[model samples]
Target: MDSPKGPTEWAEGRHGVGPWEGPWPDDPRFDPTLLAEGDRRNVVDAYRYWSLEAIRAELDTRRHPFHVAIENFENDMNIGTVVRTANAFLAEAVHIVGRRRWNRRGAMVTDRYQHIIHHDTVGDLVAWARGRGLAVVAIDNTPGSVPLETATLPERCVLVFGQEGPGITGDTAAAASMTCSIAQFGSTRSINAGVAAGIAMHAWIRQHGDLSRAW
Candidate 1:
């Protein structure tokens, strides 16, 4: 049988002036297939040369049950990082509370694969989570919060996080079913919001997702 060539092979070789400069760099960081095409921004193996909208449509079909919510009142760049992490984890959706416009530079277009919703305030986020039958689990370092490692994460829960400096607001805390914290003995008061979100997301995956899904 002849080789199973696809349209992608033709699209890869075509490039615009500044859009995707001359020849793809020979650096090991660049995939050989991508080099043949053009464009050099890190993305999943299946996404190279695929239009952003195409990748997003495929991701939408495989989205997970868990959702991620973040406070963007302060316009913290961590929100973008959180969205990127959520895309990698295949979260069901991302909820942004307080601000509609956030820094998308760090997301590096990963948001296109992730479902993002904007809410006016913490109350709106709480209501949305409740309507979806999702438990609102807040990640913060509070007195009664349990260690995230030992907590029994819900399968269909919304993992909510706050900005770096202020932590979660009082209203958000009150809206949550429970608040969980990462155990630490270091001098730092808490962990980065983006890192904390990823850890929490993985924890949920461990508790409910199928083991074979890891591969």
Candidate 2:
């Protein structure tokens, strides 16, 4: 379940280090087995031998105020990619609307370190966000959508995305406080949900994230 801690999968040097050189540090965050057998869990240097719980705990403490939600109708494969990117961005949480089972293969195990919530319907999702004073900002190329590049994203909001092809349902779009659309010059009708989520999340980061903390 390990795949580096904190930021994105910019894990360089895929090969991990050898066993402990001397006495291991007295830290509960480290995994004894990993220290003895050497850490080759495809993680970054900063989280070399840290236990899964340790990484999860650390990420929870510093997760951004923004959240990411994806409509999972028809078992969208893009959900995984969205999750992986969310972990990289350190979003507060990820919400899965509709079906519970989504293709995790694209996530590359990043979901293990990220927090995920399941909503039975769009109404449920919207209610949850509003109850917590978080704005629901949907992403889609629907009519009258604001250009995301220049929009002022809410500091504490849930950036919602829809599956590719059909895109977001009319109800979902109507329920959002505001809908944002990414600018595109290509011939394609619209980009996939996963790519849109990444763009939207980065936009929020640009507005509220602390650059010095990025790793």
Candidate 3:
């Protein structure tokens, strides 16, 4: 095995293995091209030089039961960030409602490892969730919304988020089994959609995720 490279070197895109320093390991997960040319992709050390498919397969074995859904009514820029955060939390999958295409820049290619499904409308997403016996939990700040800090998130549920400014549509909210709001101390009326998604996912992790499995 080659010596581990420094973070600065990797950031500069000048790090990673440069051909096999010794007899190559027999692991089939390692990509020959990445091993020879150096893998500069943004990935954990456990997955260094591993093929994309291999990494995704490993993630699938431990992904949480919770799913994430975002509304893409107007090319919402925050959708990608939500997907990226879902990957970080190892969400079961991501559902996009309203639009098929979303900005991928924020996802930083993590979407390749995350399973994504599209729904033509909120009703379709609700139907899919019901069919799977998964509850729909909406994250939004509105009248009668329970504070997330005090709420009990469903272990197997789809967290639904709305567009950047409009928030959860009435139709979407009607479908949710419960609506949760992150408690805020500041004067801001609401947090960014991406940030809210991360908080909501973390809330789920705190309640039900296997902490021993986290790296």
> Which candidate gets the maximum lDDT versus the true structure?
3
Q: Estimate each model's TM-score.
A: 0.79, 0.92, 0.93
lDDT of 1 at 163: 91
Candidate 1 global lDDT: 0.81
Ranking by TM-score: 3, 2, 1
Q: Provide the lDDT at 142 for model 3.
A: 97
lDDT of each: 0.81, 0.89, 0.91
The TM-score, computed over Cα atoms with residue i paired to residue i, of candidate 3 is 0.93
Where model 2 places Cα greater than 4 Å from the true spot, the runs are 1-13
Model 2 lDDT at residue 212: 98
User: Please, what's the RMSD in Å of model 1?
Assistant: 9.7
lDDT for each residue of candidate 2 in 8-127, tens digit (9 for 90 to 100): 335654568788789899999999998999887655678989999999999899999999999987888899999989998999999999999988989888899999999999999999
How close to the true structure is residue 80 of candidate 1, measured as C-alpha lDDT? 84
The weakest ten consecutive residues by lDDT in model 1 span 9-18
Candidate 3, lDDT over the whole model: 0.91
Off by over 4 Å in 1: 1-41
lDDT of 3 by residue, 79-123 (tens): 889988999899999999998988898998889999999999999
Q: In angstroms, give how far residue 45 of model 1 lies from its true place.
A: 2.0
Model 1 CA lDDT for position 110: 79
